[model samples]
Target: MTSQSISTDVYEQAAAWLERLDNGPLDKLSKRRFINWVDAHPTHKQMFESMLITWSSPTLERALADAKQTITLKDHLRCTPAIRWWQTAFICTALVIGVIAWQLTPNQPSAIVHQYATNTGEMRDIRLEDNSEVTMGSASDVYIKFSDRHRLVNLKKGAAYFDVTSNKQRPFEVKIGSASVVAVGTEFNIDRGQYFTDVVVHEGAVEVAGSRDDKPVLVKAGEQIRITGRTLGLVQSIDISRTVDWRSGWLELDNESLHYLVERLNRESAKHIRIDSPALNDIRVAGRFRLKDPGQALNLLAEVYGLKIEETAERYTITRLP
Candidate 1:
């Protein structure tokens, strides 16, 4: 038969028949029928071979079978051409309905924007997509993106100490509030929220820029920048290692008040704690303690200064007895 005799509808019907017969053993009559169909036209043999190859290929067959049920029959037909008009008309309507249903269904959120959170008194170390490392503090969340042009990370809440790998071509940038810190091959801490943007540069240098300003300040080792609104100030000559001690599972309390220390402990301790006496709030506590055991730290605090520890339904309160 001539190519004109082989219509698109005919080819589609033959393809569908091949798909149906994909797994079954071919009988003598069935083989003869197939041969007769192929001989009907010059294009018929070519079309049958194409369909047979498609149905037999492991990759194509597996993909077709695993395809969502919501897919329209017309879509499947459209992807492959056929030789008959009547068969196309028969499958077109069902295919159209399937396409509509699939289109209307909501898709899940993209893997790129998925958010991960850490609870209070917890610290988690995560390796980012760009081969950088991050150790997040209590109640923190972060996301990463490694696009063609640039590498980026969004620290949604709380603080995190970052050991950024060097990528001079595409400098690493961290955003906290309206302030941001950009660096290349550096270690830094960003404590951010609505109230403040505190950046402590441990190694190398960070270019600090406020969202409203045209220029940024270069903060090097032993320096920290605290920004609130458009105002920025520097706290000079601070020990960088002390600031990053939390990564080693230690809370370094250097000339910090008991009230502030307790607050830090609440973030580092799994159990809730409280301060009962107002007088003890201003008392200074200095030293480093293992973050793994807040109870041991509390005991050390009580032993060093003859203090009393009490428990309530709400929290574990520490007081100074007269």
Candidate 2:
């Protein structure tokens, strides 16, 4: 290929990697591989770093900045439209980079594990090789293991809503902590929360197994289950639609702790929201907050709950009102 063609390819590849990182979580191995890709070519590093800096705040500029730079990315990554360079690159990157990442081997072993994750407050929708769909929530990591035997998606952290396309020969399973959720052509939401793994089935039934010694419990549609570590908890029925509201860009809280609510609200914004007093952490809050304006919601919370908010360019802190 010509020099221009090669340059285009490299720029495109770098943009695609940045896209994957933004669209979903970048696992440690993938992240390392990306760093290697950046290091191998100065152009790759420049494009990647520029795109990263454009989308994220100034804080990440240092992290994405290369030790020794070559070309300036202002010409390639950004356009005169005042468009966000990184956002465009991210959504478009997935269209390419298919052949580079995953290749099917005749003898697929469990060793071929692909890890994916998202940053704090970022949610992603990704499709698996088997056509299974995964919607990942913020601060989440997923390990995908597709072997000759079975297809597994391990929710290492946070939450994911799975829409499995049926394959009788290979059952779709999601591993959370020590528990495994098994399903066949089903739709369900699994949340790896701070204390427990919450499961809600929407379309089909799933067998939830916490431990090898424990019996696998069948949780059907409209049913919910919670487990922590390797221990099982009670199965209850819930409104599946109401629970997965975050997918639609709304956070519904009903007497939730102030600390927890603050965390969720923070995810919707670039600003870090902190509770000034530990005592305020346990204060219960109830409301339906829209993701469109998290700061507005925070202000409303402060006003209603008698909380004081302190703002800075870096972050926003919430303290009890005198």
Candidate 3:
């Protein structure tokens, strides 16, 4: 083969490799090798660049969509020639696009994608392009995708308060587990935890529906609703402003038990607090406490209930005094 042909083959291989890398973690040695290769020759770099752009072209994306449609049936995944051929074609197209996106992206210190995560007892505020804002709660990870047609956010895990900008033409939506919360203009909090998914509406209105085949229920201001994967229940009334009091460094514990309060505090603060006594679950506490300083709250808890607070490497425990 001529030198030109060899270079073309290398570029093709690079594109395929990049597409695969998009789906998984990159090995350090392989990444180093690719970097060195790109730096070695100008012609080789041009070839790689050309290949990347071609693969990510609109034409390639359309081809991939066509390929996806062909493999939609379960029977297609079985050992069959037709399915195998379609998969091969689809994978090839995807590689072409993947290479273009990866190679074209600037080589900066933040090479890999940076995912946003909120730690226990910490809340993070993120601003979106539409001038909307999201206040994420502890242990939350959210991915945002904005386009002309829609503003989408995937609440992969945890909870977040979304103060969305009103856009009647293109609605804003959040996907959590099997439920989706849609709003044209609203401020709401969506919680996805072990028990159930909760949507607390603070402003305007939001439509909550199951991701699968269920119809959505519309929730308005000062209302909250909980949905178990399949069931969408009634909307309960709430003190909208006070419900999200944590945003301003205050925890509104309205007849909440010491057990639940600890859970809320753990989520609101960067501390992992555990209640050692089961009896504390029945001890109801209602008050507004500033979340800025957890130490002061601990001191108050100790003084009120004569409880002992112990801190360990992994967690903090509160136990009743003997």
Candidate 4:
């Protein structure tokens, strides 16, 4: 099949998956199968992520299936070379809609800006005057600046989700580390790690840049872009549900590094969790683990990987089981 046909088919399948998920809870097997489907194609995950954001309203349920119910996506392709993006976002918007990052850069001129933070093992949600919403992950810190000129959120550490209300006149912007993501009206996620910054666009589009001199790259819905100390990295597809699963108090991993996973989990725990072996970073991990109970999550990790856990007065250490 042509690439256009393939894209349509993926959207159709993504709509079906979103419908299934909305109808009921997703079991482990189903979640695993879904992950495999996303892994099957890079764009597949991005498409799914986009759908997740578009379907945020109750009015949009089954919007995708209905869009092509009698008049299927394939039927439309018979006439047009490709479907329009607004139509795509509209159809996909009715698919995965549900509920809806960062750092500290300088605070530009503003009327009144504020700071928000989440404590260890805490998650907080904030609603801004512009109807924008922000969800901060554990131990995250951010600064907000709202001026007549622009909307800004500075993420110093941890992660956050920005569901920005549209205002073409005042574009929404996020600053994390040395990176900046700008959007007019959109929903996106940003993770400012110690080493790198990750940005995922669940809806709308984003422009990412390193600093003033660095050129910006556009990141559309269903796509993700990342960068470290350098300028913008390559934009890529992402699994939206997996990316923001923390919103539901769960962490979903797909062969993710144990060390990396520990680093995130550490933010939610009073005592830091450390890995003695760097090779542990290679261990493939999967499944949905809760973030509320770090102890339970760590215990499951130890059991799953057959690793020894040494709990000292000051630290929690993980090592290969003897």
On TM-score, the candidate that comes out on top is: 2
Candidate 3, residues 115-136, lDDT tens digits: the string is 3578876779888778999998
Q: How accurate is candidate 3 locally (lDDT)?
A: 0.65
Q: What is the lDDT of candidate 2?
A: 0.67
Candidate 4 per-residue lDDT over residues 207-288, each given as its tens digit? 8987533678999998987677656788888776556456777788777677657878887888888889888876877767
Where does the lowest 10-residue lDDT sum fall in candidate 3? Answer: 105-114
Cand. 4 Cα-lDDT: 0.70
Which ranges of candidate 3 are over 4 A from the true structure?
Answer: 1-115, 120-122, 228-230, 241-244, 257-259, 268-271, 277-284, 302-307, 312-314
Off by over 4 Å in 2: 1-111, 241-244
Assess every candidate by TM-score: 0.54, 0.62, 0.58, 0.61
Which runs in model 4 stand beyond 4 Å of their true positions? 1-110, 239-244, 277-284
Worst 10 residues of 2 by lDDT: 63-72
lDDT of 2 by residue, 96-116 (tens): 222123223234342345667
Model 1 residue runs over 4 Å out of place are 1-111, 145-150, 191-198, 227-231, 238-244, 277-283, 303-307, 312-314, 320-322
Cα error of candidate 2 at position 252, Å:
1.0
For candidate 1, the TM-score is 0.54
